[model samples]
Target: MKKNIFKIFAALFFIAVIVSCRKEDPLNVDFSKLNIDNPVANTPLDTWLTTTFLNEYNIDVIYRYNRFYHGDDRDVAAVKVDKVQPQMQTVLEGFLLPYRKVAGVTFIKKYAPKQFVLFGSGSYNPDNSYTLATAAAGRNITIYDLNSFDLSDPNTIVNKLRTIHHEFTHILNQIVPMPVDFQLITKSTYLATWTTKSDESAQADGYVTPYASSQPGEDFAETTTSLLVYGQAWYDDRANGSTAAGKIALKAKEASVEQYFTVNLGIDFRALQREIQEVVRNTYNYQQASFPYWLGQNLYKSLIVNAAGDPIYSAFPLSTPFSLVNNNMKTAIAALPYGLTYNFMKLNFTSSTAMDIEINFNQGTRSFISRYAYTMDLDQATGQTKFTIAAVGGNDASWVGNANLLRPAVQPMLDYLSNNTFVADWLPTGVDAVNYNKYGGFYVLGTPANNFYGLLGQ
Candidate 1:
């Protein structure tokens, strides 16, 4: 009996030793229960944020069991764990979660945000900055890497909400697209050495800022951010202030953005922009002062005039009774603003089969600037033609002030007239249409109205 008892004890001791030898989960650590005075037991996190904080955007949370700790000396390292909510959720709610819920919302999601990684401070990457949200193609966002997750950042709107908003902007534009013509406005003169130049010099060139001239993708994201975050007035002010180039750059961006959302397909870009600013006000728990809101209101007004009665386009020949006539051309002499201006184009039709458009952009103000023309031909087969807009260099608004950062991009649009083009027509001849498409540095020139004598279908 004594020998048997000894054997059993030895077996138990071996089992204990084996269990103690298991490896630690590098990304998992449990902080002591968050003794927040009674977070309701078993209540889902989404329910908590909604019932307690009043958000209407759908909330999905995956808990991460992790811990993180910080100090200059790295002496107080604590394990960290947290959860990830959707990046889209924050963006939707940034202004109108409730309205979206009623409307059955839309957002660009090539892939859903990743699993909320739960781990302790041990999982923190020494090389990573304060990342409240992150995504891998196959994995979910790993929250709780509490480096810059500060509640006290007075200058930053850097909570989980703003972080998600910023990241989602990246994800959406990645999937959808911005106008190609925006790049044509300033083409190749974009600079890396812009910081060395003053804002005035940069403006003379056509960039909104040295920073904005960085890249095509950056321009799209920043443009989206500006409209969605600051609203149109803010965008207008950035263009109008400081330098001639900045203003010019901004105007092109504004027009392209309007064209993209209104001409292309998406949310009412101008209206949604207003809604986004309103979201910033509501979610962060502050009402915008009248001054800022009007700035936004006025900014939108610049893009579209007040429509108290019937729209003038209602009278166009496409919708109204009319016939082909060459005697009428809309032309007027006026000083172009710091932004965009248009001179009428003439497409001369020869016989019943051939036609071509003669295009010339504005001459510069004060001292005469250089002039250039882009030519395009109408197609008989596929109904396609090609043309290029300038990429850089137009003093049309150069005297008004331009953002040097954006000029390189803006100048390309002017230069595109000099570039080659390949155009596509969805509607064939005779069915009058004023279609517009923006290639990177030029506006495409193919219209149903080009060969207006008779419909191709006729």
Candidate 2:
């Protein structure tokens, strides 16, 4: 009925147009009144977007502000022409490439959002909050506050990427449902007035952030995306800061997210995490994403140096000061009256302020362990740790007999550790991502070539 009514109205309009046209001759009609210029003419940005996004992935980038793209009530600004490319460059490197590396090019091309809409200013809310990003129908992602973007600021890059990943996670959930087990992990704690809650408070209740407490869907997205952008170190810091129950809940959610990506999506989340962290470290140069940063956070409890056996120590060229000391200790211990061979040394970081230099040795079938305690002054900001030997000792008979007997032999290694301040860092540059966490060591602050690295363990 509506279609027939529209057709009748159209016929009446056509008759009126014919009568009007008869009143004026065809040549007399004015053509200059019509506007003929293309409003959507291709700019350089358009051409780049076409080749980079549209041509490669069938994605459309709409930076020209159209009021219809946003809500009627909200007043948003158009994206600055210059800021568009840099913002999208981050999207390409930080978001798209990580997934491409881990999940494969085809997976992202299949599941990635079809359109991106950029806005200069934020999409403000009546509640005094603003939207950073939003996704619709698994097809469109709109990012706001592009005018304030700073490519050089790691936090700015991370914040934008986090929101993008968060929205993308929502898109993925729409395609493949999030695990029901994730929802049940913190079911009773969710709040409708989540805005009133602080992130600290929400984290104590097992939510990754305050927004996550709003719903189970947001919880899953926050947990997944936070890990992806902030890296595992940030997640570990949050988990460690939570209450006992909250820690358990967060860990459970992490496991669920791992399972979701690994089992449901056929993506290795850890491998994806490594790829993303590499970008965070190398591309963004985020200090918190580095291994040394986590070491200071006490994420890894111990670092073992077995120079005589492990080849990685040498591969990282840990041979200079550390290998020299390792071989000397072996020689000195071998020269003892009885048959004794040197074993690996372990630096047990008992706490942020304390560590134990545990020296191990073998005589025939028996292994003797001696421990010397030291207080550490760690400047986490500078990645430097200063060690000072404790005046007292609770040394057992083994330490008294073996350590005292071998003190002159091991004093050189002891002085090497205690005499100078060292900068802690991951030693292997350009090594495989799998081996990143496998080795970390310290270089003497003033003398970098005098450094030693070892296998790390929790």
In model 1, the runs with Cα more than 4 Å from the true position are 1-92, 95-103, 106-163, 189-211, 263-265, 282-289, 292-458
**Per-model C-alpha lDDT, please?**
0.40, 0.85
lDDT of 2 by residue, 229-251 (tens): 88766887798889999999999
lDDT measured at residue 129 in model 2 versus the true structure, 0 to 100: 83
- Once fitted onto the true fold, the runs of candidate 2 whose alpha carbons sit more than 4 angstroms away are 1-41, 306-321, 338-341, 350-354, 362-368, 373-402, 418-421, 430-439, 444-451, 455-458
Question: How well does model 2 score by local distance difference test?
Answer: 0.85
**How many backbone clashes can be found in candidate 1?**
85
Can you write out model 1's per-residue Cα lDDT over 192-218, one digit (the tens) per residue? 544465656655555544545656655
lDDT of 1: 0.40
Native-to-model Cα distance after best TM-score fit, residue 149 in candidate 2, in Å:
1.1
Residue 272, candidate 1: alpha-carbon lDDT: 57
Candidate 2 lDDT score at position 441: 79
How many residue pairs clash in all the candidates, one count each? 85, 0
